[model samples]
Target chain A: MKKYKGYLIDLDGTMYKGTEKIEAASDFVKALAEKQIPYLFVTNNSSRTPEQVAEKLTEFDIPTTKDHIFTTSQATANFISGKKSNASVYVIGEEGIRDSIVEKGLQINDMNPEFVVIGIDREITYEKLSIACLAVRQGATFISTNGDIAIPTERGLLPGNGALTSVITVSTGVQPIFIGKPESIIMEQALKVVGTSLEDTLMVGDNYDTDIMAGMNTGLDTLLVHTGVTTVEMLQSIERKPTYTVGSLEEWIEKM
Target chain B: MKKYKGYLIDLDGTMYKGTEKIEAASDFVKALAEKQIPYLFVTNNSSRTPEQVAEKLTEFDIPTTKDHIFTTSQATANFISGKKSNASVYVIGEEGIRDSIVEKGLQINDMNPEFVVIGIDREITYEKLSIACLAVRQGATFISTNGDIAIPTERGLLPGNGALTSVITVSTGVQPIFIGKPESIIMEQALKVVGTSLEDTLMVGDNYDTDIMAGMNTGLDTLLVHTGVTTVEMLQSIERKPTYTVGSLEEWIEKM
Candidate 1:
């Protein structure tokens, strides 16, 4: 616990799932406040903007400023902006994708887009799919925010934007340049927000495949939380293991 | 038409769709018969076996034998068999996938598989996904039957097993070696079947993106059919034009 200075935390499965927030998530927030240690809420879910995520976190009684949030959406936009400063893009996604692209000062139009940006388009129509496919086949760059296939819902799992991306992939047979978490782009942003040396920072989350994998890929100490998506049973059965395993952030705070 | 020996046709858009066979499909077959033109039904649709496809074609009263049919599943199995000879595979697909893999004299079990062979798992599950991802990341070769994300349905086009393939991709960053039509891998198999030269082979279909693009990529003559998934409106709007466009395969026979 003494080795960790700043925490790079995950949202969604780690903190909350839909309307129901995690039990010890609030305690983790309080621990951060009491310790006065820097931490940033980072997520691979590109469905929401940083401001949107902050609002959700604040609504859950976890104090979150806009500055404390970073998303894959932000990383993707930054990456695209650097590559093509003013290229046109045809988007097949939601407000998050459009806003991120626009923030990077990229243009989004119906025709002659230099790239067909496929993000998480939950409201995907056949018309939109056809348009996105057409633009990509004409030699436009294809970029996606994240590659999550399905999101767990109250009733069941629903297909996410990754499904929409596959539509274009089938047409073009080209993979998108994914610039989200674990891709080194968002990890850089997280490192900046946490303001801790990479060696001293810790990423605490539930999903080992995404959260722990991203931290490991970015050279950060990772803590595996086992209450959310990846349950204790699932973790114990797995062959690949994590650095540090904790029941909840509250337990970690007690140890600290 | 004069430059070709006989056409190696594709199914779906090239010949028929569902219960509503293309208007000129039967007539086109008759023309081929009259001219003693040898043609093989090559399809990337891994859902149905060659025999199943042949049966469906016969339902339309079009003369098709099991011997005259070749499928991507068959090609994929042949590829894997030739490489490993008798390696074990963890099969996560349907009858077509199992039949093909078994036909190649390959051993399949639940143990440590040499490869995790992913075909069209129409009824895809989270357990299968987790297993496949884990197996592939653990150094098992991840081979995809084809890369078609969606197949046509009465409701609309539904995302296929190829959509699921992206999960393994985002997890491992390992591109799948797809053995299906439009890819040179399957095209080579179809060519080998007919003993036909690439110049003489015509890849005919309704979809310009996959079928036509595959033809274009492999230097095979292509004919875009109007009666399938792609409408004339959609075709006219896109810049990736097909080599030749036809109202129907029956009408295209007139050219020959």
Candidate 2:
């Protein structure tokens, strides 16, 4: 196996399966830490701040700090900043996205914004949607953190940011620029954050659709683990297979 | 001109535009009243009760009663009642839909309902959407009052029932049975309510997409009036034309 200089890894399914730690995943990260391999956890979850995600990883015995996380929220903020620094944004999201946008020195304006950014917001309301629709109709650049239609929960799949974003999209007849995995924008942002050249970096995740596709979309080699989401049967149906497939993260630890 | 035994007319664009009453529309309805031509106002608005709509029409001097109005909420209730009497439903809408369901003896149940119905709600919340998505994922038959993506308001075109419905539809990957204009289900229910045969009834409206398409879908002759949404240029683009076209209701009043 060719050794990559840096790694961009997915959280949730790849690292752990929703609060339950994957022991092999912990060992894999520990091995990377031991080998001094630079790695960053890239996630589509825009509701959680880097500290919260790092804390979660720490609980799972995976060595991680706030700087080791690249959230979609951060990517989204950086994306807007790149386009136009100090851009006025009307944001619909939880603390993560809000914090990211604020930290980036962007103006938060509801009346007339330069951009309308949507992330997963549990406290989503019709009024917020109305404001977003109005802003979009007024020619604001629409952007969504991710296009995850459903979020997996204990009860069942709940409505995700993509579904919520549809209200503004369907109403205003405006399509949002989605920045999460599977879309090349987030991958490019993650690559820049990790300071890795595309050819020398490996994108690792358990999901074929998001993680693996993100890697492929950004022209990076991908390693798909079977710890979560995509099963071997599900993977077989896909036309373009991941560069590497492993039964567990333990199998990929040797390469690090 | 071929005289029709009954008329299924649209509100908003046809009778009035927002709060402004169409002067010629009042005369047309008066002519229908004088001729004793049975007419029912079929509306896609599931937020207003039949009584409320009738009251509005009365204010405009467009001879109407509670019995002469058939809202999508009532149509939705009738549609559900036809399938299973007193069926439990998880509703995500306003008082109009709520009242219609209860009045029809149907139960409003949030947990494990037989059906999930969506209508326009200005006070839409994430919790309501979550419940609807959960219900739909649990195998509930999903239904939307209408598929009108944008609702015309003084501010501008706001998110409509169809746009709100996309949350559950996109999240659950379930396409709802839309029970409004352009759907034969609502038209069939309206036909039964007005006691009119499809061949003998004439549908009149200003919007070609909803009213004209509804009539066309139900095999009813449609009269397109150029007072509201669908303009002459828009009508020319459509492959299937309305049976009759007029500049105003005053032109149709002569035929009556």
Candidate 3:
């Protein structure tokens, strides 16, 4: 078996499931730390800051710092910064996206902005959507953190950012550039932050559509764990299989 | 030219355009009244009640009463009442839709509603959308008043009911039954209200997509005026043209 020099990990299903911690997650991180191998928790969650995500991981006994977390919000900020420095933006999201934009020195402007960014906004209002539609119609570049259609919760599957973004797209006839999982943009950014070559890095997750697809799009090997969304039976139905499949992280500890 | 027994007239582009009355519109309606020709103002606006719309028409010196106005709200109510008399519904809209549902003896219920109806609501909230999504996912029949993507105002085009409806559709992956112009449902109901036969009734409007398409779908003759959305150049591009294209309603008054 080939050994990877670095790893890109998923959060919700791979590291933990909601508030519950995965028993083998801490041990997997400890294995990487002992070998001095680089790894970053790549997440599509643009709602919380890296510090918040790191704190949650610490509670789960996972050895991760703020530097080990790379959220879609930071990727979006970096994506925009690469295009143009100090660009004006009209944002419809929570603290994490706002912090990332501010941290990258992007100006948050509602009227006549160069870009219109949408993330997960639980407090979304018609007025906010109206402004976004108007801005996009006025030729602002539309961008969304992720294209997640529905979010799972105790209540059930609620509307996600992609569903909310459809209002503007359907109204103004403009599709947004999604910057999160399954898209090569987020995976490429994660690779740069992890400081690893694509050939020597492995993208690991329990999901097939987002995580494995992200790895495939970024020219990296992918390891699909069965501890989360995609089961072995489900993977068999898919035409393109991931590079590796395992029941849990414990099965891959020997290779690490 | 064939003389029509009744007319289904569009409001925004035909009778008036955003608070300003067309010069030929009042004269055309007066000609209809003098000849005792039956005509109903057919509008896709689900936000305003018939009484309110009638009042506005009266202000513009157009001969109209609440009985002469046929809005999409009333058509939706009629459609639901025909399906199941006094059926329970979960609605998202202003007073217009609520009043119509109640007038038709339909019950307004959020918990386990038989139908999930969407109309234009300026006070739309995430909670309201969440409930609608949940109800739709729970096997409730979803319905939308119109599929008009944008509403033209003095401030420019704003997000319409169709845009707001996309949120629930995208989240739940359920296509809603649209009951407005271009859908034929409202046109069928308007024919009943106008007491006109399909062969004798003429659908008149300025928009080619909505008014003309509705007429074509319902197997009625259509008259396209040049005062609103469709232009002579635009009409030339369409493969299926209106039965009669005129520069103004005054040209059609002689035939009436």
Each candidate's B-chain TM-score, in sequence, is 0.93, 0.98, 0.99
Give the CA lDDT, 0 to 100, for residue B193 in model 2: 77
Compose the digit string of candidate 3's lDDT tens values, residues B16-95.
Answer: 99999899999999999999999999999999999999999999999999999999999999999999998999999998
Which segments of model 1 are wrong by more than 4 Å? A1-256, B1-3, B230-243
TM-score of each: 0.58, 0.99, 0.98
Order of candidate numbers by lDDT, starting with the best: 3, 2, 1
- Report the lDDT tens digits of candidate 2 across residue range A20-125: 8788988988888888878999999999999999999999999999999999999999999999999999999999999999999999999899999999999988
lDDT of 3: 0.94
* Tens-digit per-residue lDDT, A120-160, candidate 3: 99888878888888889999999999988888777777888
Count clashing pairs, candidate 3.
0
Best by DockQ: 2
Clashes by residue pair, model 1: none
How large is the C-alpha RMSD of every model relative to the true structure?
10.7, 0.9, 1.2
User: What's the ranking of the predictions by TM-score, best on top?
Assistant: 2, 3, 1
Instruction: Report the candidate with higher lDDT, 2 versus 3.
Output: 3
- Alpha-carbon local distance difference test for all models: 0.76, 0.92, 0.94
In angstroms, what RMSD does candidate 1 have relative to the true structure? 10.7
Which one wins by lDDT: 1 or 2? Answer: 2
Provide the DockQ value for model 3.
0.79
